[model samples]
Target: MQIISQVFQEISPADFFYRNKEIAGFSNPARAIFSAIRELIENSLDATEPFGILPDIYIRLSSTGETEEEGFYTLRVEDNGSGIPSEYIPLAFCQFLFSSKYKLKQTRGTFGLGGTMTILYGQITTNKPVEVLSSTGDSKIYGYRLMIDIERNQPIILEKKVYENDGQWHGTIVEVNLEGDYSKAKPKVIEYLKQTAIANPYANIMFVDPKGRLYKFERTVSVLPPQPKETLPHPHGVDVETIYRIIRVTKCKTLLDFMQEHFHRVGRQIAKSFLEFAGFPEDTDPKRLKPEEIVKLVQAMKSFNGFLPPDASCLSPLGEEILKAGIMKELEPEFAAVTQRKPSAYSGHPFIVEVGVAYGGKVPVRSDNDITLYRFANKIPLVYDESGDVSWKVIKSIDWRRYNVEPGMPIAIIVHICSTKIPWKTVGKEMIADRPEISREILNGVREVARKLKVYLSRKEKVKREKERLSVFLRYLPKIAEFSAKLAREEKVPDIKNLLRRVRRFGEG
Candidate 1:
């Protein structure tokens, strides 16, 4: 038997993502366009909302190819936020796997490939470089036309120019021409922006579609959500690789100092106790630990439950008021109920769930009798893969009839999960893992709001019945009075005005 030799080659991150575009939601023309718009707008939101600034974002997508709906389109997104500094522009936009979201904080765009993936997609599809204009609220606006060197995974700056800035206008403007099916992508893209508005009511977003149609979501709130603070990783959730990495980089001489400095909620005393429990001396050199020792340390840490619940300060959940305001502004529901669950930990990562239920008015009723669910994670809208999300799983388990909300009713449910580390089921970051703790909190939060909705619905039903009864009396009372007056030989009907007034008030109530 003859054996054939095979070739082995290593691929760059850029090349890998390019070959497997579906991993980043760039599987088709429609999805690619939607993902591109979603990525850039999310970045803009993260830039402003965290710093207590009211965000003003604009997106414009226009068809550039001969066919209006299909083929290449020019996408432009601009934001009024602290712009990317000039020096960091190229790498930040071009390099793959370079991101600040790796920190233990609630931030959007976790993988850091989101923005660059859009650029890479555009470059390969249309063979056009992206145009970027940025200003740090300074006197100069740096403009560039650049593309990624796919093989080397680097930025190729074609042109760079400095322009006069208004000084007060500080933000970023990114434009790219990419192949897309805008006609097919319109609905999902619009829904994404709408959900983004619902999640971040403090941000103003305006969009101009490929057809020149404009949609605006104005800010309903002025105050921003509390910014999420970065925290250290918890020992219980970390793996041997994480511990080994920390050990290699840590400057601490002893295991006690390393533990105290590296992990959260591990004080000096806790560190000493933990080291002892792990069969390591307090003065044991962390750097001297072998691979097997690191594995043992991780196992001990995971089994130890002495650590306090994670600090919730590292999370930024939208309070009940802001979420309610957002729902009211977008859905214009006649009644809205919102609640925020108390902080909870899952796998040692802190998480909070905020739920809002809206009924009647402008809330759209689906023909399929399914609830309209708006899901968000850390203020980023989860538009795709709705059925797979933990929020969806919880929603499916709920019996809406129990809350007096019938199928196909004009109702919308909004759920936001705030966590430093989201348990994403896929690299797409669209669906969340159904962790028991997260699901429980979501269940509780949704039930709380649903109960409020039930109360409103019950009262509404009573008023409806009252009005129906009043209608009958109103139709016959005057006739009855006239007949009675005629039979009694009176010229005027009995004065029933006061009685009618009382009945009218009751009906209204």
Candidate 2:
């Protein structure tokens, strides 16, 4: 019997993602267009917030072909933010998994795949290079037309130009052409921008659609949320692969020094104790550790006690005041309440939860009798996968009746979770995993705001009842007064207006 040989080959990150575009949320033409817009806008927001600047973002979509589904469209997005350095433009747009966001902090894009994947989709569909113009507050602005080398996972620069700047221009502008269904994607894209405005209140976003329809979401405030701080990994969350990578890259000579340097809340004493528990010498070189030693170190870190829960300084949660203001500004609700939960942890990564509830006024009732839950992770809106998210589960478990909310009530619930690392259940980054600690924090936050809503609703009901009672008394008071006047043999009916006024004052008091 003859045996056949098997051939194996390694693939680049770009090639792999190109073959499986669905994982990055570019499964269809309409979704690809929406994803492209989202990625570019999110990148702009991330860039501007770090500088504490109110973002001014502009987006334009124009069709270059006939049919909507089979048409090619050009999308241009420009932002007023801290621009990328000229040297990094190619790698930033053309490469995959090369991101400055790898640090432990609350950021919008987690995997560093969104921006590049968008361009990759455009390239594969329309065979057009992406154009990027940027300036880092320098004397000159740089422009480049580049394409991705999928197999090499690198940028292939086609053209480069430089222009003298007036010192006032600083931001990024990206333009790409892709086959898309703008007609189908128009509503979703607009909704995304609108929700983004509500979540960010400090951003002014303007969009020009394929039909030349201009839409603008103006900023409501000048204040920006606090930027998230970079943090070290927690010992409890580290595994064999993470340990190996840390050991390989660490500059510390000794195992104890490496542990203390790489992990948060692990000081000299904690590191020494951990080494002792792992049966390793404190002064042993971390780079010389064998595989077995690494496994023991990971187990020791996991089982070790006395290390404080991971520091929460890395998270940047929207405060209750800001969240409520945003919800009211967007929904125009008659009553609104917001709560920010204290710091919590899941798998040793610290996180914070915030929730807001808005009722009545412009808030629309759902026809399906489902609560309107606006979910956000790390301040970025989660538009899809509502039923699969942990926040949705928490919402379903809530008894709306307890808050005096009914099936067709005009209410909106907003939830935001900020963490160094969000537990996303899918590669698309559209849904969050149902971690128990995260669920508890979300539930508590929502319940806190719901209690406030209950009070408001109760007061509203009381006022309604008072008005009804006053109406009934007004309807019957004249007849009663006439009868009493006749019985008393008086020629004129008694004036009860004064009595009515006094009664109203007493009731109000």
Candidate 3:
């Protein structure tokens, strides 16, 4: 561990964190497909906004190869989402750690990690470039396609072009050439896209395969997931520097107003309550409060139990309708859809979950493989290897066959959280590790959902099968008709034949 830390310390910040070869190489073709598509998907989501205009995304897969080559492929994703402004084009393609939206819990581009990684990976693997065309509201369209240096982490501009446009329209078009085997990544890509579609059903997605095949996933509904509320800095959440700044700029002469402004979920009444708890008067002027009174306010704040739930309005909720749209769009529409779940608590976390179950759809049957489960933390798709995931263990423990769901046949669930910190193991923000405590917490959370669904489906399937059985019995009547006609021709049992003839005559009558 010491050696590891020493080696880590020796590496430059960029080499150590942003452009690590090992981290970049962890993306196989399957994972790469997901990463590439997710980058574009987030862009699309950002474009379609509070205006409620349903965004249209088109994915075109062209086999850049005329020959029988498997690796030469180009994938294009075009979206009518809010396009990148012409001025920010360079920053959008080149910048990392800007994370302007990082503090935002609801918006999509928290890390600015996903898109930049795609550009980096494509540059490294194919030694090829990527192209991006973006337009702002009523702005001229700017197109940029470039490759970045892995060692230096800078763009090697391959193309800088623009399209004439008016400000009335906005969107982004991105295309990349990758060296990995596109065919093998097809199913995983399809599955990932399908889930993304279900999750964002309000958005329309179109995908084309390298074989010139096309797939389009769109949301039929116009309702979008709610936007995250604007956040105010919480005093407890602030660092020392920020706290000092607030202290310097505070206009209210007392600590009471300071509490209301800096801390989250605490209102003026709550701040007043805290002051009273600390033995200060409710009407005490904030600017005139004594230093001792301020200390009391701080003490009362630490003890207050009724502080409004962490101003979660700043956190976005992935509505049930949108999630299902995301799923049905990418995957086959034959799923048993459950949109949103009531908010549930776990380990002091306040989260809302939306689950979609596809029993037997167009999903493939695997070669004795465990079922493929896609796990997302805070709406970000995680690509960690499945073996280490806690959800996979819970999945394995249950007998999936009982639900008429085979290992490979379109069987999966989705979990979304709205908390400050997800309990995921890595910064990639994918799956939860298989620690017993966390595993138990997640399993328990999903159990109620599973139990209710299982009972509901079991009864539904039983009724369906009973109808099928009756239909099967009805099929024998035709055979019986043929046999009765032969008996009439032979006249083997005169009395029995006579009775059958009478019955046939009655049927005819």
Candidate 4:
């Protein structure tokens, strides 16, 4: 045998994703199908909700080549949203890292990596082209059939078409073919869609599974959460690299203007004071800062105490009212308590935590655990890796029994973390990192709702005791009334029914 030497070469983003697909949650056929559906739905949600459009998303999974190709499937997702422009269709669907989500905002995306990974994974698995059709409420409908050249990270368009539009329809539709084990992925895919419905009760989602079963999650609320606003980066969050990138494109000349323009809540005075504290000249050219000087600036910025904390304007948290409404509609829990924690920050990135507790009614009970914990980041459901999640860690540490909750009870807990940057444990975004600040907030929020649940449980227990007492009295009170009437010899029961009505009213109240 002849030995060969190793060679080094640069690889494109598409090629890297193709070789290391598991990093994007496409480890196997089952998971690939699930991830594909999830990515498209999330993309649709970002498009519609942020733009003030009530979303109507449709998904269909059908068999494509069942006999000839093992487990081959066709996945189609359509959304009534702000459609993409004709010129941007190729870049939006095929290009890697080309996105509007690279800024400081709360969105369910990863710099456009998630959607492209889905497209690339499908192309590789089935060797098939993708079809996309869209209209942005304009009078032109554009359609394209394309495939990605994985080696070069470019789109190879196979066909393009233009059609007459009625101007009444506005949305996008994407269809792709791939290999998947729908039977195996059914449970997870259904759970994801259900969880998504719980989080976004204002959106209507209809799904058709591979076996032609229909699942519908209809809107239970009429209002949507406030849209998240794009914000400036904070000084505490920036590093030398972040500064360098901004400086490359920034229009500001001097460092003083640069700080005030690029960082959140930085004023002219604060900028000057910070420069003085960092020992850098205030009039230094921002674009000309040396590497060593920029490093010092970053270190000084973190140590400075004059900067104000970041605000929650960049986060869109679901209000307690909306959360409770959704829980009631979906889980039908007899008791529910939800709390939207006040805004907090870490690494200069503002975040908010929302915790909800529900018990009894239709909430499923597991004989072994009897708990259903739903975790989310930036409104996207995290359906895997729960044991290592930050929220779950905080939950396990809490004394839930103090709040009249325990194992083997029909209970569900939802923890939602919305921030411009979620500290995820992995690149797949399945779990949250156990940051002290974020952990403390989760603990506090969960405890707040647990206290409310305790009150509800106490009242419910009192009502149950009252009902039992009323039952016993109703059984024996009639005998006492009959005996008294016979002894008095006047025969009428003396309207004992009125007394029973009063007792019932008192017991109920």
Candidate 5:
């Protein structure tokens, strides 16, 4: 018998993602279409939000064959956003893990993988190059037809051209061909768009589906959410590996300087205390520190009690006023309440939670629970994995009866979590992990909104009871007046209409 040898080889990012498309949320034809659209729209929103421009996004999905259920389809997404620079266009579309979002701030796409993965899926499925056209408020527009070299993880540009522009329009347009099941994906796609409108009432979105149906969600508000500011990482969130990497790249010469400069809430005094606790000299060069010393430093940072929680400047939550307006405008609920919790942190990442509860009117009441929950992370809607998300767990644990919510009640629960780093359970980004801190924030936020909803519902019930009592009293009041007038033998009957009017006014008041 002969012995066999095992062979191992490293693959490029594109190749790895192509082999495992499901990890990027492109599990099937239907999901692929939804994921592609979602990624593109999210990028558009991110670009527009920074400039405080009201987002105007256009999407077109058309099938090449007679029917959308089979064969290939072309998807084009265009946005009025701050377009990508001509030099970075190819890398922006084809390269993986190349992102300006590496800074510590709240953003929709964290890994810089969503948009690239979308194009990769399209390339693998249909063997077609993607078309990209962009103008960054420049005198000319740049266009390119590109494909990703999976083995090399680089962009293969097939065609490039420049067109003279008026320098007025600044936006990007991307078109790709992919094999997808649009008919099946239609519901989720529409739902995602609708929920996006509800969350971002300042955006105007239009879509033309494969069936040539036009769907548009117009902006209801003009104001946009505050942009998140970049922040430093907190000490508790850093690990041994992270510290090693920081030490290697940090500009600070000494360990104390490195600590004070890199980590949030760490000052000169705190850095000195940390160094003393780690048994390292304050002037010791961080680069020359031994591996054991690094471990000790990490441990000391974790155990230090004086370090303040992570800086919350990096988080941008939807304020209560904006959130409530969006919910009211979209859901048309008779009663709506919204709450934005104070900034909090998990490990070293700052986060904020916003919750809204809408009741009655167009808010659908599910048959099983009479409750509908909408979950969002960093303004991007989470359309799938409801049961697995932390928000869902918190929602299920809440006692709805306490809020006067019952079976078949038309109620919708909205939860939004914004953070520098969201705790996602899977690479799909469809579900948030059930971290204790995140769960606690969600619970408190939802409870606050629910309490307000309870008050509204309670007052409504009270008014309803008052109306019923007024109706009964009005009906019997006329009878009593007639009887008294007859007993007194009056020629003209007592006029009860005036009394009824007075009573009605009192009831209304």
Candidate 6:
């Protein structure tokens, strides 16, 4: 056997802290696109909250140069909402892997890692810089602009420009250059923009191509999504290491007090239950417990009953109305519906789901092309490849042929789910838990909407068929008139054609 000491060789700092440096350094182009878009979206959502304005967001896409590898694409996203404070510019724009927004409840970005990754992605792809223009309510602009190095994972401050625009400045504009074949990624970029417009019906968006083509999406509603709530950590969720550290370091007399100080959502009811079950009084000195007693108490704490479920007070979600409006805007449909599932308790925390679907018309149901499927855990859209997402999986399993949707006809569908613990499959946040319970909930909710859609389509088809039959009968009227004229001229046939003409005229009349 190898020596125990040999296995514990010296390790470098870079080895542990810079893990996944490539991904952290510069992500793939498609992922970068996803990242960039996500950053702009997050900023827009932030602006729309609090003041309760239906968000007005704009996305513009343009390509420079003709050659594939030599070509360049720029995506510009602008949002007219609550702008960032001038003082927070450095922390909001330049900092890497840092987030000022964090709460215990369901939020889109708990880690605050997404936005920086976007700038990093652009830096890696272009080896250049990114520009930003942000302003608060009628305040002078404080733009903390910079260029990032992908290889070194460093930010280089470029220029800090003062604002000169005359209008009330309450928005931000972000522009970035990245190496991409815009021709290839154009469809996807457009689809994403349109879907975003639909999902955020309260937000107005506009896109202009490099060739001078423009696409604009405006919100029809006046309502904005709800603001996010703060969350608290679960007491039971703390590991053994955490509890041991707390017991050793805390000055509290009882375990209940320690729980209250360190853990969140832990009320007196739960503390009393944990103490009673552990055979400890509320006032028992935590320092007095022997090792055996501690073990017993820990076990009892684990088995404690009637612990209040995790409160969803901190969970924030964009309301169903707004989410549906945004979806229907891009995936225009004859029938569109949204369903928000009741809050569900999981591991003592409450979670919920909001699903939206649009049936009829062409929403491009093609396997070769990535279908415009949008998923938001809370209110943030997952921007990675959606081929293997839960919604895509459900789409693949469903029999679309029955709906008379020819192979690649457009069929738009959008889904959003909110929970304290999202079973996200990747850092890209593209896939969700494939477990039976989650899958079952998603499938059932979508199927109900699909059922209603199928009925609507079938009725429409029936109306179309009836119209065609009536048109065919109308086409015979002229021929019948000619025959009647011939019979009248022949006379020997007793003018049968005349009789037929009369009958045809009566029918026409």
In angstroms, how far off is 150's CA in candidate 4?
0.7
State the lDDT of candidate 6 residue by residue for 166-194, as single tens digits: 78767877877765545555666676676
lDDT of each: 0.90, 0.88, 0.61, 0.88, 0.88, 0.63
Of the two candidates 3 and 6, the one with more favorable TM-score, higher being better, is 6
Per-candidate Cα RMSD to the true structure, in Å, reads 1.9, 1.8, 6.9, 2.8, 2.0, 6.1
Model 3 Cα lDDT, one tens digit per residue, 110-156: 56656777666666667777889887656478888776654564556
Provide the global lDDT of candidate 1 against the true structure: 0.90
Tens-place lDDT per residue, model 4, 53-105, is: 98899999998874623789889999999989998888888988778788788
Weakest 10 consecutive residues, lDDT, candidate 1? 63-72
Instruction: State residue 414's C-alpha deviation in candidate 5, in Å.
Output: 1.1
Best by lDDT: 1
Question: Pairing residues by index, what is the TM-score of model 3?
Answer: 0.72
Question: Candidate 4, residue 248: CA error in Å?
Answer: 2.3
Candidate 5 differs from the real structure by a C-alpha RMSD in angstroms, to one decimal, of 2.0
* TM-score, per-candidate, Cα-based: 0.95, 0.95, 0.72, 0.93, 0.95, 0.74
Tens-digit lDDT track of model 1 for 1-509: 88898899998999899999998889999899999999999889878887777999999998897779557899999998788889889998999998867888888878989999999999999999999999989899999999999888899999999999875778899999899888888889989998888888999999999789999999988988888888999988899888878877899998988988999899988888888888998888989988899889999998887777788888999898898888989888999999999999888789999999999888888888898898999888898999889999999999889999888888888899989889998777899999999999999999999999999999999998998899898999999999999999999889988899999997886
TM-score of model 6 vs. true structure = 0.74
Once superposed on the true structure, which residue ranges of model 1 sit more than 4 Å away at CA?
166-168, 482-493, 505-509
Q: Which ten residues in a row have the lowest lDDT in candidate 5?
A: 64-73
Q: Give the Cα RMSD of candidate 4.
A: 2.8
Off by over 4 Å in 6: 1-27, 50-53, 59-69, 72-76, 125-127, 147-158, 161-168, 235-267, 278-280, 284-305, 345-349, 367-374, 395-410, 457-509
Candidate 4 lDDT trough over 10 residues, lowest sum: 64-73
Model 4 quality (TM-score): 0.93
Model 2 stretches with alpha carbons more than 4 Å out: 1-4, 67-70, 251-253, 279-281, 506-509
